[model samples]
Target: MSVTALYTDLSGYYDLMCADIDYREQSNYVRRLHELFGNQGKNVLDLACGTGPHLRHFIDFGYTASGVDINQPMLDIAQLRCPEAQFTQQDMSDLNMDAQMDLISCFLYSIHYNQSIATLTDCIASVHRALKPGGLFCFNAVDKSTIDNRAGIKRQLTHDQSNFSFQSNWYYSGEGEQQQLQLSIERTTNGITEHWRDQHAMVALTFAHLQQLLEPYFEVHILAHDYERIAPWENAAGNAFFVAIKH
Candidate 1:
């Protein structure tokens, strides 16, 4: 209940922040990838699974699903959203699993929440250890090298009599292994308005560096970041999906 800021006490507003995302398409794409390059099992572990939107779809798709997040408030909402699935409070960087998963996924670039390259390495290792042989680890990521500090995405929506505006962008200083996800939110209702801003630290790396980190534990494939199509990463885009199979 102490979630004070974005992804924390403000967990109740999480869904509103992501109302524009197409969860169904993202889920379907991952399922398609699993069918093409996985152990063909149904057990899945969703990392940093805020509000469990993807878990909802995964359960509906007949997978035995479980989710882990650092925010308990988010987990509470996720439990209500997908009562048939299991939820846990845990940091994904040092993930612990009771059983091996057939697939482990981190969506919306949440993998970067590990916050530092060293921690991200730990997360990758943890994912490798928690997955069964040939199991898949899938996630999307942005290249820090391609980050445009001046570019951002903004949207406005009306929900339950309240109007909400959300802005988010990536900021990289052109060096180092650090980046920031800068977020700003504004909500107005009946002449009352409130504002919130947060800067989330993230691990910054090139796809080449990330591939090197995964090579020791998995067979890695970098694919275009398109939920509608599965194709190799063209090396020209700022975002891409990483699909790794545990060796």
Candidate 2:
């Protein structure tokens, strides 16, 4: 699949569009999670590492980090941001690595790009194969309940020189096994306006389904909205953070 304008033409504006996200705090949380659940070593692989913000902080946190993204333009920016770390262009489902990592993290809900249960399973199994024994795979995901709750929501961000708005709507398709998201993005800069409409499809995997899929390859541990470890049923309606240890 070709890279969309959202990731290519709009790649430079991604950080600005998400200016509210505290990468430092998020990276600290991830580091803490790794400390609690990761192996002794600090070899880390960040999947779908857009612009390398987290990897920059991971390097600061004293980990040897590498990043992989399918988009070259995004990887280019990431290289400039984190020059010390290695970067690769690869699909998450077909992840290949020469050396195993102690920890692998895919953040920012990038797993949704898998678009199918089969591809998502392939990505997870690939991560399992790329990890050393007892290595950790940590990621964040939005379940169907949360997606349904937030459907048709509009979010906007404004900076000094530009204004950006995003509206999202999701619906079930194909016998309820697939979910499709339609995103409308509008940007205004220096009196110039651009509008882009993008569609993303993902497998509608519930919390229970996710647990079942990971059971064969990992010991799954789920966390709540605040990134603290919790039972899966505790925060069943919100975003979930997963820490799965390879068996």
Candidate 3:
């Protein structure tokens, strides 16, 4: 399926469906990670910065913020949300920036969009090259174990004139190394209903595998859960957060 089409359909309702997310708190946590692991510079880049809520927070906190995403519709919304920052249309796997950043963040498990280990490696390499020496990279991912354990889930929401519903299911293929998230969405606005369905693929990587992949270009600093610092193995919930520094 075309990911661009899926996101284009979702762009208008993205923030509505994600109303539960506390972007301020999440951004504060990202800032804290930068303070703990970064070089204390103000230049920051947000990868896959959909709708720019987190980027707006970084800007509010006085960072020289910039954002990049593959979807132009999403970038359009982001540009409106944070006019002070630059927004670019680019894929994470082949990101190019004229200036290196002091910190780079890919939040909300956006790294999983790479869909394959080879592409994920390319994405990480791009990020490494985009970061200045001692710069920090922070991201979160769903562990393979977590993907293996997922069950079918459903959600519904109503915001203003739009009503939204989504059903999600998970599948594993290729001897459990690849995971897929199947999403079915229905949106009704002003009494007009639209349906969209898409399956997104991700390369399931264990904490050790991800660490090994990054060790070549970055100093793996922390692997925790839910933004709290903890041992990687202790994260029974399958949500993993990572902070690394470019060597």
Candidate 4:
């Protein structure tokens, strides 16, 4: 499906499908980063910031926030939801902003949307260029090993005023750095069934791979792994979040 159609078709049930994703906790983590690094008079750039849910968290922490995403429908939701922050519909690999920001964040494994290694490196480089000296770049990626071992994972979850029942199925190839996630969600609204599907190709990049690629522009740090949080594999939950400091 076309990118526009993907976002447009799912816009109606997007919120419902993702109501239990715990964006608030993720946002709070970002706010903590801002606090640790001093966010006063600093700007934040949220790359691939879908619906700006995380952007709202940074704004609450007293940082001027801006975001960019290629999906216009999602950007529209973000703009409406967080009018105080600026949201732009732009590709992650070739984002052009006025100046470098203090912090640049690509959260929720959003960086995996880039289907190629070159594009992934370029996306990281673009964020590197968008940050000032000593600026921090944070992002998350899915570990290939975790996806290969686990697929067809289902969970029944509920949110405020809504119910989220989803099956997380993914295809991962151990031979290369390519993976696909099919998030099949069924929402119950007043006992009615509403279904939505989000197919995402989550590019897998090793910690060393990214660190080597970003060494020229950033001092990379592997913050944490998704160990025991999502799957049974030791240190293999398909999510490796890291922070890199720009020189």
Cand. 4 TM to true fold: 0.82
Residue range 4-122, candidate 1, lDDT tens digits: 37777678888988888999999999999999999889999999999999999999999999999998999999999999989999999888889999999999999998888899999
Give the Å error, residue 122, model 2: 0.9
Q: Model 3 lDDT vs. the true structure?
A: 0.83
Candidate 4 or 1, higher lDDT = 1
- Give the number of the best model, judged by lDDT: 1
Model 3 CA deviation exceeding 4 Å by range: 2-4, 149-153, 174-176, 189-193, 228-235
Model 1: residues with Cα > 4 Å off, grouped in runs:
1-4
Predicted structure 4: lDDT:
0.73
The order by descending TM-score is 1, 3, 2, 4
TM-score of 1: 0.97
Per-residue lDDT tens digits for candidate 4, residues 99-184, read 88998988867787777788888887788788887888877766665565454767676665667676766667676877676777
Looking at candidate 4, the ten consecutive residues that score lowest on lDDT are: 225-234
RMSD of each: 2.0, 2.5, 2.2, 4.3
Error of 4 at 216 (Å): 1.7
Q: After superposition, how far is residue 206 of candidate 2 from its true place, in Å?
A: 0.7
lDDT of each: 0.92, 0.82, 0.83, 0.73
Weakest 10 consecutive residues of candidate 1 by summed lDDT: 1-10
Put down candidate 3 lDDT per residue, 90-208, tens digits, no spaces: 98999989899999999888898887889999999999999999999998877775565357777798877688897766666536567777778888998899998877776777777
Reference-based lDDT, residue 148, model 1: 97
